[model samples]
Target: MSYRRTTDFLLHDWLEVSSLQSRARFADHNRETFDAVLDMCEKLAAEKFAPFNRLADTEEPWFDGEKVHLPAASHAAAKAYAESGMLAAAQDYELGGMQLPCVVEMAANSFFSKAGIGIGGGGMLTSGNANLLMAHGTPLQQQVFAANEFGGRFSGTMCLSEPQAGSSLSDVVTRAVPDGADFEAEPLGPRYRLRGNKMWISNGEHELTENIIHLVLAKIPGPDGKLVPGTRGISLFIVPKKLVGTDGQLTGERNDVALAGLNHKLGYRGIPNTLLNFGEGKFPVRGSAGAIGYLVGKSGEGLRCMFHMMNEARIAVGLGATMLGYAGYEASLAYAKDRPQGRPMGPSGKDATLPQIPIIRHADVKRMLLAQKSYCEGALALELYCARLVDEAHTGAPDDAAQAALLLEMLTPIAKSWPSEWCLEANSLAIQVHGGYGYTRDFPVEQYWRDNRLNMIHEGTHGIQALDLLGRKVVMDGGKGLQLLASRINATIERALALPDFAEQGNTLAATLAQVGAATKAAWATGNPEEALANATPYLQAFGHLVLGWIWLDVALCAQARAATLDHALLQGKLAACRFFFRHELPRVGAWLQVVTRRDDTCRTMDEAWF
Candidate 1:
């Protein structure tokens, strides 16, 4: 099957993206420069990342009871990416970065993801890690670790999940004690010794860089000499793989971070997912009992500091899933167009003498292809919209920034979970489109599906995100965020109404929006938190569908406005996708909203024994 990059949609339908760059004060990056960056990314990914994608999957990382070893091609691809300077593409020039807008950076990164998500993950983690430090790290910490990370001399990881504490960060038992007296004074500030084991750490241990900067979450004891309970006591720390001195040079002494083992997975096997032991006594640290580290921010504010990286990561995960689904869609579309199969339904025997037509001529195949196109492309719009919101929150006018923040907060959970859910469905349909061959490893769709399955669980599970959306975000600040989002969607609906071709879609979305608002109130009317949130997942689904409906209408309006200027086929494709979503996909919102609006409790009220 022929491969394709979905970034084409960004250029054709999302012309407003350039305005975002201008708003962010990216004066040097006009449309030409932006396209140049994307072109370079496509070339690099096709050459360095794509060739090794299947090899990395087949030869997964392994531990030799001493060190972790990955394919040499993995290192070559990572080095190529780092040397390309894309890792710090969004950072300031003073920080040795390209100073591109966040939206442009995300657009460029999507190319790598389409080539391979596992390789793409390393860059995402490093970029997020560097961005966090740049935001909250002390001056010296930023100069040393963050600089190295941005320069690609070092990579980074976020250690949050422990064997004992997966998502329940409140139960984390990692301990950090002041040990500044033992270590010489350094530019990174006060030091401590971190002791605990971190599980499911991606890029935890590798030779991809000179060193790994670990942003660890642990607790520092109070006067009672006992660690405080829950997230309130947690603090962030910078733990490195090898100790560094005040001169920004390696001390030649390995830190107390050891790899306990490797967790082999079904997909995204390019980078090593590890079980890491910190200060486990398997490795000694200057006669110390734990890993030496420096504080990131104030004590008891670890979760707050970590949120900087987590939020960035959440959106990146959504983009990753979107690209994977898109890759599969492209592959399937190519296959459907080229592979001829059974005759059309009119008359089989009469056409036996005639050439067999491609599967794309069949109505069902078109249905599946259209479904894939809508879901994947709609997801692309949602993620790029979120990225633009990030840019607006940082650099827009004061009122615009405030409004952007509110909308971002309200839609972030949807950004993470909606794409994860629907894009995975796109991958499934892509597999089905390939028939028997798609189920086998010989084709890429199976791998795409396996890789996408992890996105639903990464950053946060679907259920966790659902609770966050329905139980917290929708109600925060007297529902100001939801109101802001509603205003934006309403504006789109109003604009779409002006176009005669989209008046019906606008009406459909407007009705869905009203239903969603009604359901939101109905779901929370009981006043009992448990009773009100019993069906949060369905509410999330309904809310997600509504958001997609709004986004598709917005996209159709954009296409309709450019109908005369854009390619005839491209414009038609966008219009067709918008119609498919409204006609076939948006109606499902009504069913989901009915459950939310009525506060359905079929599962909530069921007895445990019924299972």
Candidate 2:
């Protein structure tokens, strides 16, 4: 299916996103406006992004002595995406935003991600940074920093991981000190001097925009002149690449921030990933050795503020992974239909005179294609469903909104990690469908696979997400989030139970859900973090499969409802994918859950010298 058709079905038919118009926030938009937005983005992505995807990959960004150089196509793609007005698509009208629903915005952006995720530029990070500032920054900070970022004049990066810290934010040693005695009197916000090195920062240094906003996380020293330990001492600082005045104009003077070096990556090579040095005296401000930064939010609340962007980025990463997988699926499917291969088995004897059939006619080929379909399409549905929940959490009635928020918290890790894992698997299968050609760079599927390999480590690694799911998200708020998720899944189960065609799947899903609940209880019954989280990744995998199963089943119900009017092939295709997932995919949940439920410690308890 075409990207447009898939998005149209998800937005209008399945999710009924147009119903969002009844909400006061989306009152100005109808199906026409939404379609227009999608149409524009689709056209722009095809013209500017798709054609250069390979160019971006082949001609990776390189650094000259003074600046970074990306393919000319990368610059054009970034400009087109910025001019498309999607960076602030869900923001208020006063912010130069379309005020589109979050679901619609997500659907629209999928086109770009599918076309070329790396060349999609820093728009996601920019919007996410602006969103964080709007939520946590002072009014002046929002006007000066967030506004410009939304306007596309400034790009953004979240500087979290350091060379030593990696994912352990508590171990971060980056320090921020008061700029002067009168630092609190600074107009933009409390002023500080930050000195540290940040590693693996994407879009950390680029000339695509007028300025780059670095939201650096560092620790403030205590009264005794020693840095406070753990995350409690951490604080967020708005460290712009260049000094900016309170009026939002560049001061024509560089800040102390400097790009130390770039990391040559395996894929997503179009965007520069850099090691940044802050307050390294590269370009000192006012004769000071430290990088000047403005505090955002209160001290000791940096992680809380940064999570706003981190969570958003996690979902966006999932969408990126999903779209890449989808692109591979479509490419392989097209190849299968056109490439003639060995003939099918016959009852009597081989007929040499018969023409070779399309590879898609082979049972094994269909199995591989079906697996990709079940993965990528279902992942697309899952991401959009989460996007819909974002809308609900933001705009729904009070009680409903609260419920949506709880459900979102529980699903966030799964939403990020599941697609990152399974969609990459889908890409592998797509390459497999292409036979030997798939393994070569001659085909795009290999690049798709390479690009997707990063998603498992992006945002948060699979292990971190697993620990977060089992250790924190499920158990937080007296388990209210998990309970809310269960309620939502069960609601779908109740609906499916009434239909004879879906009853078996519904029962299977119910059993899987029960198993998940049991595993959660069994894993945590001892109240030991080590024991409970020992097999957290397995727990995550099992729980994610259960969630995807629910998503596919729910989507199948929608397809069944439109059976009379929807195309026969499309309806069958949806139902078939759902069936394929339940029969072929969902059963794997049991093996994964076994380790979680039993708290297996084979790997966890292994000796350090075992290797």
The prediction achieving the highest lDDT against the true structure is 2
Error of 2 at 389 (Å): 0.9
- Over 4 Å off, model 2: none
Candidate models: Cα lDDT each: 0.87, 0.92
Q: Model 2, 236: alpha-carbon shift in Å?
A: 0.2
Quote the positional error of residue 379 for candidate 1 in Å.
Answer: 0.7
lDDT of 1 by residue, 447-475 (tens): 99998999999899999999999899999
State the weakest 10-residue window (summed lDDT) of model 1.
1-10
Model 2 agreement with the true structure over 455-493: per-residue lDDT tens digits = 999799999999999999999989988998899899999
| Residue pairs clashing, model 2 | 279-291
> C-alpha displacement of 608 in model 1, angstroms?
2.9
